[model samples]
Target: MTSIKTKKILSKAGYYIFVSLLAFAMCYPLIWMLCSSFKETNTIFATATSLIPDPFVLKNYPNGWKGFGGISFATFFKNSGFVTVLSTIGIVASSTVTAYGFARIRFPGSKIWFSCMLLSMMIPFQVLMVPQYMMFNLFGWTGTYLPLIVPSFFINGFGIFLTVQFIKGIPRDLDEAAKIDGCSTYTIFLRIIVPLIVPAMVTNGIFAFIGKWDDFMSALLYLNKPQQYTLALALKLFCDPSSTSDWGAMFAMAILSLIPVFLIFAFFQKYLVEGISASGLKG
Candidate 1:
């Protein structure tokens, strides 16, 4: 019995070690990018195997800030911020209201509508991309942020689904109590439901923020004007096939672009975890 217990402990330890190594491997690229960003162009090639830069440089940052053709990093940052903030707010507010209706309120065709919502999630964004682009073109919204920001007002299927799951976890007794106090449905949603599901809101908000921040293809396809480009699009400008790429500056910008996302995640990480956990528990 003693021998068996010892073997089990060793097996668990081995499993943990394997998992840790796997996690490190998965994260290695991000670590490499961060280190490479601080290195000079020649130094990067020299210290290819080393994680730490032997000679660090801060010039890459300013170089990256002034991207190709004098396009400023400030412009990209501002554009991205505008789109991300508007989209995040829209997604959170719309998704919350839609999720509340689906989770708690009974209405005609609610079940069918809910099923349709799930079905929408199964449809690939690629399938819709061309049609969406055509629609935007028809409205002459191309080369602007409208194509990116406008759709966010409509509740995203995944956000709605996730929020619904979290909302379901909240006790209906709260809704009933609110009703007894002569609270309207909208008031109940505002005063009670919104507060209770703040964790899920944070989770969804973080996801939306990240999605907008990292969006590359949409920005590439829709934004024709360099001045209106997001960070993702701006990063691609650093890669010049005509000459050797400014890899150090490119990586530097990439690292700097992640700062806002990191700050957001750090701020709301606890709520995000709680929201996800609570949703699963309810489901």
Candidate 2:
């Protein structure tokens, strides 16, 4: 019995050590980038494997913030905030309502609609990008944030699917109880369903915020003005294939861009895990 206990302890220790090594390997690129941001631009490539900067400098932050063509990096951050926040709100609202309908209300073709939503998730975004661009351009929304924000108000495939799964897990008796108490469908949804599903909504919001915050292709395809650039788009400006690139500033801004993502994950990870686990979709 003692030998068996010792073997189990040793196995657990070995598993943890392996996981720690894998985690460090996965994070090494980010760690290197952080260190490179502090190093002089000329030596960044020279000290590729080093995690410590030889001569630390604060110039990268200032230079990156200065931005280009008289626009400040603050503008990019603001634009990202505007688009991402609105988009997240839109997705959560739209997806929750759609999910509730599909889950509780037995309408004609509801299963068909649910299946379609799931199918949408299987289709890659690249498959629809060009046609979507042309449609938005026809509506005269190119060069604006409308193209980015409006579609989110209508539908989000993964968001709807996630939420539908979550709502299905909720017992229908509460909804029936609310109805028997003379509550309208909308009132039941608002008073009973919404409150209980707050965790799922928060998960959606966190994902939507992170996804939209890191969006580069949507901004690249629709936005033409530098003032309208997002952090992801503005970061691209640091690299000029025909001219000298500012690697230090790019690395600095990259680190800053990741801060919000890290913070959101840290604070709301419990909700994320709970929502996914409850939804019956966890892999």
Candidate 3:
């Protein structure tokens, strides 16, 4: 019995050690970057093999924040924040309503519409990129944030799919009970379905925020002016082929760029698990 207990303890310790090593392997690049962000610019690559920045230089943050072409990173951050926040809100609100309609309402052609929405998820974005660009250009929205923000309000196929699956997991009896209690469909959605799907909505919000925040392609396609550039696009400007790229400054800003994504995930992480599980996903 003592031998069996000892073996079990050994097995658990081995498992933990293996997981810790795997996690460290995955995070080594990030740790290296973080350490490099504090190193002197010229010595960054010279001492690249080292994980600890000797005498920890602190100028990278200020230099990177100075930005390019007389424009600071503050502007880039503001532009990104504006676009990401608005786009996220639009996607969550529109997707929630669309999912509710598809999941709860029984109208003619509902299945057909839902099938089309699902089909959209399979289509590559590259196929639609050109046509979308032309349409926006014709509407005179190409140079504006309209192209970035407006489209998000219309539809989000993944968001709809996720919320629909989650809503399906909910007992229909509660909806029926609400109806019997003189609740209109709108009221039922507002009071009952919405509250119940908070986890799903949070999951959707996190996805939307991250997608929009990291939307370099969309911003590159639409925005022509420096003032309108988002953080992702602005990062590209830091690389000047004509001159030496400030690797240290770039790394500093890159680290700053990661903070929002990290914070959002950190705060809403529980909802992600709950939402996935509630949507009937399994390991």
RMSD of each: 2.3, 1.6, 1.6
| lDDT digits (tens) for residues 181-263 of candidate 1 | 99999999999999889999999999999998999999998999888899999998888899898999999999999999999
Candidates 1 and 3 compared by TM-score, better number: 3
List model 3 lDDT by residue over 162-193, tens digit each.
99999988789999999999999999999999
The clash count for each model shown is 0, 0, 0
Residue 196 CA displacement from its true place in model 3, Å: 0.4
Q: Please, what are the lDDT tens digits per residue for candidate 2 over residues 201-248?
A: 989999999999999999999999999999999999999999889999
Consecutive 10-residue window with the lowest summed lDDT within model 3: 274-283
lDDT ranking, best first: 3, 2, 1
Q: Residue 68 in candidate 2 has what lDDT?
A: 97
As for candidate 3, its clashing pairs are none
Clashing pairs in model 1, backbone N/Cα/C closer than 3 A: none
Rate residue 130 of model 2 by lDDT.
94
